[model samples]
Target: MDNAATTKITENVLKAMLPYLRENYGNASAIYSLGQKSRAAIENSRIKIAENLKVKPSEIYFTSSGSESDNWVIKETLNPREKNHIISSKIEHPAILNSLKSVERFGNETSLISVDEEGFVNLDELSEKIKDNTKLISIMFANNEIGTIEPISEISKIAREKNILFHTDAVQAMGNVKFNLKDIDVDMLSISGHKLGAPKGIGILYIKEGVEISPFINGGEQERGMRASTENIASIVGIAKAIEDAYANMDENINYTSDLRDYTIEKLLNIDGIIFNGPIDNRLPGNINITLKDTKPQTMVQYLDMYDICVSSGSACAAGSINPSHVLRAIGRSEEDSLSTLRLSINHNNTKEECDYVVEKISEGMKKFKNR
Candidate 1:
């Protein structure tokens, strides 16, 4: 239900974090015994996360959130030089787009690749945008709003051939997809903890060996002086546990959620004036974004709240804004179509009953809207 924005933390992750919050509270930079213990815990978490991604622990840099990681990668790659050119897609999360806007204020150049009706970027156009001055290519592995997975491997290959740095905001695709750093070979990648069932306020940036970049924050010698400030030991530990749990059960979880997604889509399709956005098959397992013609998404969300069913129209980060979804617009949706879009992301914890209830409530909501 609330899967698009975030997910409820699992009991295991919570349990792992309790001890650090309660007794093991110590600064990781301190040389005391307690500090050493906390530092060891952080290191272990980094190793586990790196193992999952098939990267060395030294390659992972923990930060405040996925947004911070994305911003850092962009600024670092384009800094200390005059020619500032970045390539990204239009369907990226606002974290990347908005940060790029900030970079542009300093005379940086950017090319936003447009997507097709299914929200997949035009790779041929993407190739054409790359120039000798293009410093970096930052794209999302999956659309947070429509759940369309991008051909990142292909994109990364192209960037490699062009000698351009590549970064992917894998926040939405981390737990849901199988990715190995060795295969992707991107220069940088961003991931968040809360998206995979860990707590918020913690994220990871994987910097491939030999990638030169500047730190976003400066203070103490943490994260090998790449990032500063005392580490969030509890959250980092929980993030590792969350990633380990998610990866271990990924296959079963994907199968279960995909079944729920298919069922939900089938029922919603039976309803009048509803259309599914994004690719039918090449999307995340639990994502189902739909446009309900003749009904406003805000009104639908309010009504669904009465049934204790939570959903979203787009990225939660951009919630409460009246603007139409940029991702939807990138996919060629009209303003009305964009305004009517509703995102119902699912997870392994969601039940078949929940999907049926959502469909029933949506149908009833539509009738009310029609009558009005």
Candidate 2:
């Protein structure tokens, strides 16, 4: 299942975007009727996204992607305050962790909390890391590689208790899990549309009310000057429609996908020398990360590709790299285990027949590798 990286857009979302691309094209800022119509469509999208997130429309800032949103929030939150310390986990996506690297150049102090064997942040260590100078705490809602779901609400509580702002990169969790911004009490969150069967280049950053931060892209006063560009009207509408549909069907999707995931995992484990990674229970519904003890992940990925069974070695963004997964390393995996890891992320559209095909391909590949 390669769906964790991106999903095929739903028919309804595609239809929702067509008019804007064809007949309704207009600069949202113009005073003309077409412009007003475009502007209204953008506002409607904002309202729907805000309603789903349980936040005010004003708090939702449309962004280009999850990376841009993560970069914007981290840079803005840490730059304004004299306090330069930040708290994050070792297993955060490069969007957050790499952004933190740039923040450090501005003389900011950073505390990276270590994760346990399951890729979960140690809450006790997280509490110890926060200090008076710690202005922001950034963590991921779920890992892209292993699908380890973090304790965001618990971490948010800690950040609230210490009066520090908290942000979560919820790109992987948004459509797959039940989330309410109010319930988490987080100050900011980031999610990308492609993760939920919408188009790429569209995402949302939820900023808590009254949290003043600088804009990432400087231009005309769009997104209240927090982000500035002519609205991506069609994609924004598509995102809103996709999120609504995903949330509405979340329960059924979870049940179906989870069954597929379990079936695949059970079949894989029946083979010799296979080990699963991440928390068995506290993980995403359709994620199954496993390692064949002696085979390299890249080799297995290539073998599977030949059989038309797509999978990933780590994060899709990092798939081209020769380096082992940082998330696996953080969870105390050996180099051998890390090199062998393969991630299979399913979705509602995946079928049992597809699962059987993948298992057959994997078993065949492993047998060949063992012989060699």
lDDT of 1 by residue, 31-141 (tens): 999999899999999999999889999999999889899989888788665867999998888889988898898999999999999988889999999887899999899
RMSD of each: 1.0, 1.1
Q: List per-prediction Cα lDDT, in the order shown.
A: 0.90, 0.90
Assess candidate 1 and give its TM-score to the true structure.
Answer: 0.98
- Of candidate 2, the 10-residue stretch with the lowest lDDT total is 75-84
lDDT for model 1, please. Answer: 0.90
Per residue, candidate 2 scores C-alpha lDDT tens digits across 1-372 of 799989989999999999999899988999999999899999999999899888999999999999999999889886554748989999999999889999888888888999999998999999998887888999999998888899999999998899898999999999888888988888999999999989999999999998867889999999888789999999999999999898889899988988889899999998887899998887898999998888877888888898788898888899788888888989999876887788999999999999998988888888888534
Could you estimate the TM-score for every candidate? 0.98, 0.98
